[model samples]
Target: MKIYTKKGDSGETSLFGGTRVPKSNERIEAYGTVDELNSFIGLAASYELSESGTKYLRKVQELLFTLGADLATPPSSQTRIDRISADDVSFLEDAIDTLEENLESLKNFVLPGGSQPGATLHIARTICRRAERATVKCANVDDISDNCIKFLNRLSDFLFVIARYENKHAGVREETWKGKQ
Candidate 1:
């Protein structure tokens, strides 16, 4: 099959429900950002990490495809939609808790740096935040599932916690942000 559908050359794209929207549609942005975040997660996962870290990130990447599907399908459509669930959000929270067990509590604001892998995870975290904001904006105009938003929120925290875990895993020191002199 040809990768280029050429149908989108008219500045429009089709959703899962076979409905067409502009390429600039908020829903497109929402799911596109999630797709972008998924790529970054893959990049971070490519780095050296613990077995559990690899497993968790792989899980997250898989779930993100579901999230992208959820965003791509409109509620009005009769298509069978993939919806985010409370369990998804809870998984992120549980992962955070598990990773935080070995991490020091924050005394000051943390800077996004440590080892190369940690920085990569920080980039993924920021992308996750942007995806969340895009999803929220999509919610304003469409019937986006609240669970999807909640999942994005928790995913960012999960990324943050994992980044910290990566730093500590590398025996790298976290640079706490100090006041600008």
Candidate 2:
């Protein structure tokens, strides 16, 4: 299939149900940011210190693709394939719980830096927040699944924990935010 169909040349694109909307549509913005976050997650995964970290990141990337599919469909015409179910959010929560089990309790805010993978995970986490915010904005005008937003929220938290985990495993000390201490 040709990559350029010239269909979106007029600044409009089709949703999953063949409904066309402007490229600047909120749905597009939300899914686009999700795509961006997925890329950053891939980059972060490339530098992960543990096999489990890479595995989790790959799963998150897959979930982002699912979210993009969900956002790409008009609610009026959406089907099961376009639905990001609560099970998706539960998956993220489970992953978060597992990762948190291996992490130390947070005593204070952490400075975002340490090993290269840790820093990249921090960047990915911030991008995940942006994606989540964009999704929330889309939800204001559309029938977005609450699970989608919940998954993103938990995924960001998972990224933060994975960053600290990577740092700890790599023998990199986490820099705590000490307000002038």
Candidate 3:
């Protein structure tokens, strides 16, 4: 199949159910941001410090792809195939819990840099938030599952914990914002 469909040249694109909307539609923006987050997750995964981290990141990447598919489909015609399961969100929660068990409890705001991999994870976390926001906006107009938003919210938390875990593993000290102290 040719990569260029030539159908979108007129500034419109088709949703999963064959519904055509403008290329600038909110649904397009929502899924596009999810796709962007997936790429950042791939970059972060490339620099993971441990086998477990790599595996978890791979799972997160797959979930983000599922989210992208969910967002790309028209809500009225969306199917089970496009929905992300609760299990996917629970997996992220489990990983976050496992990583947090080893880290010191947070008492202050964190500066978002550390080892190279940690910094990349932080970048991915921010992108995840943007994707979530975009998805929320789309949901306001379309029929999006609450679980979808919940998954994105938890995924951002998971990325933050993973970044801290990576920094701790790398012996990189987290620079706390001491403010006027």
Candidate 4:
């Protein structure tokens, strides 16, 4: 299929099942943020990462596509797509639990800078938050899956933990936020 369909020239796009809506539609905004998150994750993966980190990130990237599709396809649509589910959230939680086991317990807010990969992960975490908020807003009016919100929430936590793990593996010390004296 050609990339330039010119179908959206009028600022309208089609959902999965041929439902046309404005590009500024809430569902579009939510999945657009998700697509942005996926791009950042791809950038993070381009850096040097541990074997497990690389593996998990690859999986997360795949799931984000599913999430985007889920958000794009409303429940009323006939398109059957894989969607965010409880199991997906659990996967993130499990990964976070495993990675956090090697890190020191958190006693204060952690700063968002480290090695390149670690810093990129921190950036991705913030984008994840924005994506989650957009998804929440979309859910308020659309039939978005509850798991979509849950997955984004847990994914942010996963990104934070994985950032620390990446820094630890790279021998970079995590800087904690210190309030003004």
Candidate 5:
């Protein structure tokens, strides 16, 4: 099928079950930002990552697709798909714990940079936060899944730790934030 479906030309788009709403709808914003996060994560993964890091990023990218799809679908729709669960949040926690083991204890906030991949991961982290906020707003007004917000929270933490890991793997030191006096 041709990719161009002029359906959204009127500033409205359909949710998963063909319920149309403004493109600016909270649901669209939520899922769209998740899609943005997925793209940046994929970018981070394209760098010289270790096999484990690569594998982990691949898993997260898949999860983001699921999240985006879930967000796109209205809760009342008949389309049944896996929504975010506590187990997904737990996986993120496990990853953060694993990666944190390799890094020094944090005494200060981190700068959003290091190796190229590390910097990109920071970008992804910020996007994840935006996506989380958007999802929260959506959840506030709609019957969305609560686990989606929880997953984004844990995933942001996971991204921060992985950024440190990427920096360490590249032999680049993390920059701790210091006030500009």
Candidate 6:
């Protein structure tokens, strides 16, 4: 099938249930950011990382797809899509706790750079924050599930911890930020 469905050429797109909205819609912004975050996660996964790090990232990518779908389908639509759930948020929290066990407690903020994968994870974390903000903005105009925002919030923390873990395993020291004297 040709991927070019010129239907969106008019600067509009269809939601999951065949509802059409402008590409600038808040739902589009939220899901687009989620898609961006997913791509960054995939990039981070391509770099050298522990087996567990790669595995968890894979899971995160899957969850991001679910979130994107949830954002794409409006509550008024009859389309059925799996949404971000409390369990999904819990999964991120659990992963954060596990990764943090191997990381030193943060006494100060750390700069966002390290091994290749670690740095990529940091980039993903920032994108996750943007996704969260976009999702919140979308919620202001639409009936967004609260768990969607919660998952993004916890996922940012998870990304932060995992980035530190990746740097630690790569033998890279984290540079803590010291405010100007």
Clash tally for model 4: 0
Comparing candidate 2 with candidate 6, which one achieves the higher TM-score? 6
User: 48-82 in candidate 4: lDDT tens per residue?
Assistant: 99998999999999999999999999877778899
Cα shift from native, residue 83, model 3 (Å): 1.4
lDDT, candidate 6, at 83: 88
> Whole-model Cα lDDT per candidate?
0.92, 0.85, 0.86, 0.94, 0.91, 0.93
Worst 10 residues of 5 by lDDT: 172-181
- Give the lowest summed-lDDT range of ten residues in model 6: 72-81
RMSD of 2: 1.4
Error of 1 at 47 (Å): 0.7
lDDT of 6 by residue, 80-136 (tens): 889889999999988988888888888999999999999999999999999999999
- Candidate 1 clashing pairs, residues 3+ apart or interchain: none
lDDT of 1 by residue, 15-132 (tens): 9978899999999999999999999999989899877789999999999999999999887779997788899999999999999999999998899988877899999999999999
Query: Compared with the true structure, what per-residue lDDT tens digits does model 3 show for residues 1-181?
Result: 8899899999999988788999899889988888888888788777748777888888888888888888876556744465787988898888999999999999998999999889999998999899899889998888876678899999999999999999998899999987995
Residues 42-132, candidate 2: write the lDDT tens digits.
8887774688787888877888888898888766674557467788778877887887888889889999989998999999999999989
Cα displacement (Å) at residue 127, model 4 = 0.4
The parts of candidate 4 lying over 4 Å away from their true place are: none
TM-score of each: 0.97, 0.94, 0.94, 0.98, 0.96, 0.98
Between candidates 2 and 5, which one is better according to lDDT?
5
- Model 2 residue runs over 4 Å out of place are 78-82
Off by over 4 Å in 3: 78-82
For candidate 1, the lDDT comes to 0.92
